[model samples]
Target: MKPLELYLHIPFCIQKCNYCDFLSAPSCAGERKVYVESLCQKIRSYKDLAKAYHVVSIFVGGGTPSLLLSKQIEQIFEAVRETFVIDSDAEISLEANPGTVTEEKLQAYRNCGINRLSIGLQSAKDRELKRLGRIHTYEEFLWTYELARKAGFLNINVDLMSGIPLQTLVDWEETLHEVARLKPEHISAYSLIVEEGTPFYERYGNGKHLEELPDEETERKMYYRTREILESYGYHRYEISNYARLGYECRHNLGYWNRTEYLGIGTGAASLIREERWNEGEIPEKLDRKAQMEETMFLGLRTMKGVSKAEFAKTYQRTMESVYGKVLEEMQKKGLLLVGEDQVCLTDAGIDVSNYVMSEFLL
Candidate 1:
């Protein structure tokens, strides 16, 4: 049977952050109970598909999955196990906001087969956390992290953000240093983008709020500094925005970059199955060879490992050079890419402008 990853989106949050554009909302207890029932129904609906695939990973992502009662989370997992052929050693992860989790909840998650915890603690400074409209204070995050550790969650990830309004390089550095000291198994450091439709966009998408935010040079410095500091703390940069201790990379996300088949359940989730992509209840779009190649390069190159030439040839039945030879040569000459005998990867400079480099692979 083919290996597959599973993602369940829980769209309820205590409050929406200013910069978030994901499908999420503040929900009441009654509404949450109803949503859990629907989510379980959706999970059971996939029984037939489960026969052909063994679930190798499951990620309960959010809004704030931890907002749900522990029993509700257990119900979702129960439905999944009943319907799917779950691998015995599958990596099951739960996304928790700092203030939303408790000792009882963490213990319940462990009992229900969740072995990893990803806590959203965007900054370690109270002022920065407040500026981002985060619901949790830095102290709350520390409490939650300690609770997870005590609850036997050996594998944990901390999420951090850079480039908020009124944030300085010192603030970003402090956040990084503080998180690293906690020694979580994984870390995801992302730059804050003022996405369209987010509250942040209304205030800062244009030059109107630029002075309050870090300048381009400062933001770039923050990005590079993240790599330097994390690496210094024994965290390896496995991807552009992800660092991990050895053997601690997020398998569900790796499934995405490797183009592994996955099923996404719940409202507004997306799935890629059998080379076709679809959103919930939508018609699948079959990917052509060119489209697949573009995905293979751009997604795979996001990691430090980059694209493996042998795997690319095996998948497409054509050499990587046959497709992106000219682009690779140009990028290499410009010191943006490092083309090795077995793999092609982006240089440090290339990663800073990765959007443009990845776009060049589109045909």
Candidate 2:
């Protein structure tokens, strides 16, 4: 059986954030209960597919996975265990919101085999949290983090964001300093993109709120400073936006970037099975070899490790030079790419303009 990663989405939240466009909504107790049952059914329905794969990682992300009762979480895991051969050391993670978690609930999660907790603490400033429509304050997050640690969760990830309306360089630096002081196992610092259809878009889209936002130069400074600050605190940048202590990188996400086969369950989730990509409950679109090659370069380049020449040649049965020689030569000349003996990776400047650099790999 092939090794696989699993992601289960819980689409219920106490409240949705202004910048979030994920499928989630405010739900009541009865509604949550109903959703849990449906989610369990969905898990059980994958028995056939489960037989052909051994589960290596399980990430329970969502609207707010921590909002579910311990019993609900256990039920979902029970369904998974019954269907698949889970690795003894599988990384089982749950995404949590600080406002919704308590000591008892966290302890329950630990008992239910959740070895990792990812807390969503977008900003260390209360004002910024409020502005982002997050229900928890910085203090609440601290309390929740302490509770998780008390509950014996050594593997933890804290989410932080940069770039917001009314945010300054000092504010961003302060947030980083405060989070780094806590010394979590991992940190994911992402730049704020004003995606369409969210409340943030209505308020800031189309340069409407540009005045409140830090200028491009300031944002770029914040990005580079994130790496310098986090690395100083013993966190290494394994990926562009992800910093981690040794052996603490998120295996589930690495699977996604490495093009490993994964099964995504629940509303609006997506899955990549072999060379096919599809949303939940839809037919997968099979990708041809050229498309696969393009995806490999684009996704792998997002990491500090970049793409492996040997692995690419082995998989495609052709030299990397045969496919991307010209592109690599052009990018290297521009100082946007580094062609090491074994791997080809993006340079610091390339990472800043990664969208354009990655586009060049498309067939």
Candidate 3:
């Protein structure tokens, strides 16, 4: 059986963030109950496949997975366990919001066998947090982290963002410094992406001059500075946006970067399978090796290790040189990709302009 990871999306939040476009609705206790029931039904429907595969990870993400009642959270895990052959040591993770989690909820998560927690602490500053429509305050995040510890969760990842409106280098530095002081097992810092229909996007279109996002140069400096500071705290860059102490890199996300098969559950989730099937929402038409190649390239660059030459060769039944000779040569000359003995990784410049590089593989 091929390795598998499971991602279940919970689409309930107290309020939708202004910058988020992910499928989520305002938190209603009744709707949450219905959604959980529907999710269980979906799990039961796929029980045969789940039982046939070896599940390596289970990720509960979403609108606000932390908003679930403790009993509801337990029931979800119970359904997954009943329907799937989850490995004994599989990394079961749940994405949580700061204010939504209580000590009881954290303890219930532990009791339900959740081994990892990814806390959404978007900014260390209250003003920026308000701008991003995050519901939690910095103080609330600190409290949540301590409570997670009290609940016996040591492997915790803090989610942060940079390059927001009104953000400056000093703000970035302080945020990094404060979060690192907490000594989380892992940290994921991402740049803000302005999506259509988001308040940021709408405001930009309306000529409402919000604080400017940092220019490209400033963004680059922020990235490098963050990397240097986090490394000083003994965290290594396992992926473009993720840093962790050794062995704490997210396993579920690794499956994605490797282009391995996983099941995506809930509204608006995308998945890749060995045998491509028709899906109308997000997948491109005419799915083929070129499409697969594009996915492999983009997903690879997201990781610090990039792609393994040997794995690419094995997957495509061709040596790396034979498959991408001219492209590799050109990229090397441009200093965008560093070809290694066993792998090919994007250089700093390559990561910054990854979309252009990845587009070439779409042919």
- TM-score per candidate, chains pooled: 0.99, 0.98, 0.95
Q: How accurate is candidate 1 locally (lDDT)?
A: 0.93
Candidate closer to the true structure by lDDT (higher is better), 1 or 3: 1
Residue-pair clash count for candidate 1: 0
| RMSD to native, candidate 2 | 0.9
lDDT (Cα, 0-100) at 128 in candidate 1: 85
So what's the TM-score on candidate 2? 0.98
Tens-place lDDT per residue, model 2, 57-105, is: 9999998998998888889888888888999999999999998898888
Model 2 residue 57 CA deviation (Å) reads 0.5
Question: Candidate 1 lDDT, tens digit per residue, 78-155?
Answer: 999899998999999999998788889988999989999999999999998888889989999999999889889999
Model 3 pairs in collision: none
**In model 3, where do residues sit more than 4 Å from their true spots?**
206-211, 277-287
How well does candidate 1 score on lDDT at residue 140?
92
lDDT (0-100) at residue 233 of candidate 3? 95
**What's the CA RMSD for each of the models?**
0.8, 0.9, 2.0
Candidate 2 regions exceeding 4 Å error are none
Tens digits of lDDT, candidate 3, 139-179: 99999999999889979999999988889988998999999
lDDT of 2: 0.92
Q: Pick the candidate with the highest lDDT.
A: 1
